[model samples]
Target: MKNNRNRQVVLKSRPADIPQAHDFEIVESDVPDLLDGQILVQNVFLSVEPAMRGWVSNVANYSEPVRIGEVMRSFAAGEVLQSSHSDFKPGDKVMGMFGWQEFAVVGPAAVTRKVQEDDLPLSLSLGVTGLNGITAYFGLLDIGRPRPGDTVVVSTAAGAVGSAAGQIAKLSGCRTVGIAGGSAKVAQCRELFGYDEAYDYKSDNLDLALGKACPRGIDLYFDNTGGVISDTVLRHLAVGARVVICGTASFPTWDPWPNGPRAERHLLVKRARMEGFVIFDYASRYEEAVSRLSQWIRDGRLRYSEDIQNGIECAPAAIAGLYRGENTGKRLIRIR
Candidate 1:
């Protein structure tokens, strides 16, 4: 074994709201021997997403919650160190739900996909070419169904998924408007992601800003944060508009069930549609999305950013940082 000891961050306690470092504890253990059908992977990068909050929360979600004392659930990029499965072999690069650990012994089913883009950075597997890119590609194109010249607005515009969604919308010849937390992110939306118009939801009067940005009303709304921002966007939906609910970062908890303005009236008045999709539902088409996104990257039609922090110790804090809007793009912890 390259290293006998494996370090991991486990969920120490469930957080009432935003996760804190105290909610997790780092522990070290001996690397286990791989069993039949199992692969031993040494993680290179650990991804942190806003959805993680729900994973550890007691609330009922699409997936099962991570129990206390378990390795915090996470998607990671890593290399296969040893494999007992015929489908996998040593030296293979892979991405999967390897959790917040330096090393993981998981069955082949846990391996989401084999990393094949040697020309691309392995870290990109956990970001642009991985979950973020795939989510944006399917959510925007399939769910949002953006049309050319459509006014498409995205919340969390500078984030990993949101940035990709906005850029993809632009590629579809839609006019894109972005809503971000601060001026810097707003600027990143307009300058970095090529959003035609960008607004700071934290500072700008969102209702009026949406009015100015989408005078023709929003033909498509890629909503990552659900709260007042989404409520405002719902009010401005163009006739037959499409809304994709990708995340709800604004809500601290769902146990109490946070309430907001009803969207039924807006949908009724505009004949619009709103829907949510889990990335796992589109797993069969993951490689397709990755291939197309990679091509876009090569053609210079797409761009993405990473807010990488070194070491597994940063794993706990990284989740909280995302909710604080501290990350500039995809938040990752370098395990090596």
Candidate 2:
């Protein structure tokens, strides 16, 4: 019999707003015998991203909700320890849709892509070159479409997608203005994330702060936080601006899925454009983004950050941290 050798975090409860520790139950399980073409992988890094929040919700989205009592849904990076699959071997590093667990028995279909070095860390394969990177690429280039010399504004600008979006805007020859939750994150936006200007949205006078930072009037708005902050940005948009709706982290809850930026009048006034995007729409083009983003990192034009927490036991709090704006950049849990 195959030995039981996995540690996992199971969803204990459906969260009302932000998930809490009580929502997960960490437990050990027996591993089943390998099927015809399966591989056992020791998960090394697991992505604890804001996108997980949308997946946890019962609301409509491109991705399905994580069913109650299931292992919390997640993306993970791992090393193969045993393989019955012809394509995989021990020690091969892989990235896949593994969940909140330390070990996974994946068939060929579960493996998404193999990790290879191209002047970047393996962990970043879970960040900039993976789902997060693809989201930034499509959301900014296709939806936010900034023009040269235009001023682009990004909310949650120190986080994974926001950081990548701002840098891409700058590379497109636009001035980038970033707004994030706190002083530390705002600092990272300009110095680390390569934004042209940045502001702390926590400032009481956020509207005034945005007005000052975006003196040229916003040309393209890559909105990761949709709410009053996004509302204020819409008022500052230049004529013919584009807004990409990627997130609403600024809101407290999603049961009602709080509304954001009733800027229809602003869009009408400025002759601007607004659209909602889910990154999975461009999954086929993910390789194109990975190649370009990896090059940028090699050329010293791009950067990434991770707030890694240890163990599956911390998964619930780690995931919840994103909603509280407690994480500095990309958040992940080290499962092994």
Worst 10 residues of 2 by lDDT: 252-261
Per-residue error for 292 in candidate 2, Å, reads 1.0
Q: What is the TM-score of each candidate against the true structure?
A: 0.98, 0.94
Tens-digit lDDT track of model 2 for 187-298: 8998898888888877747788768877768889998888788888888988899989998777657567565547889899899999998876786787889889998989
Residue-level lDDT of model 1, residues 1-336, one tens digit each, is 545999999999989988999999999989988878899999999999888998988888988989999999999989999989999999999999999999999998889999999988998898899999999999999999889999999999999999999999999999999999999999899888999999998889999988887888999999998988899889999999999999998898887888879999999999999999999999999999999999898899999899999988788888888898899989999975
Off by over 4 Å in 1: none
Q: What lDDT does candidate 2 reach at residue 36?
A: 81
- The number of the candidate with the highest lDDT is 1
Candidate 1: residue 145 lDDT (0-100):
88
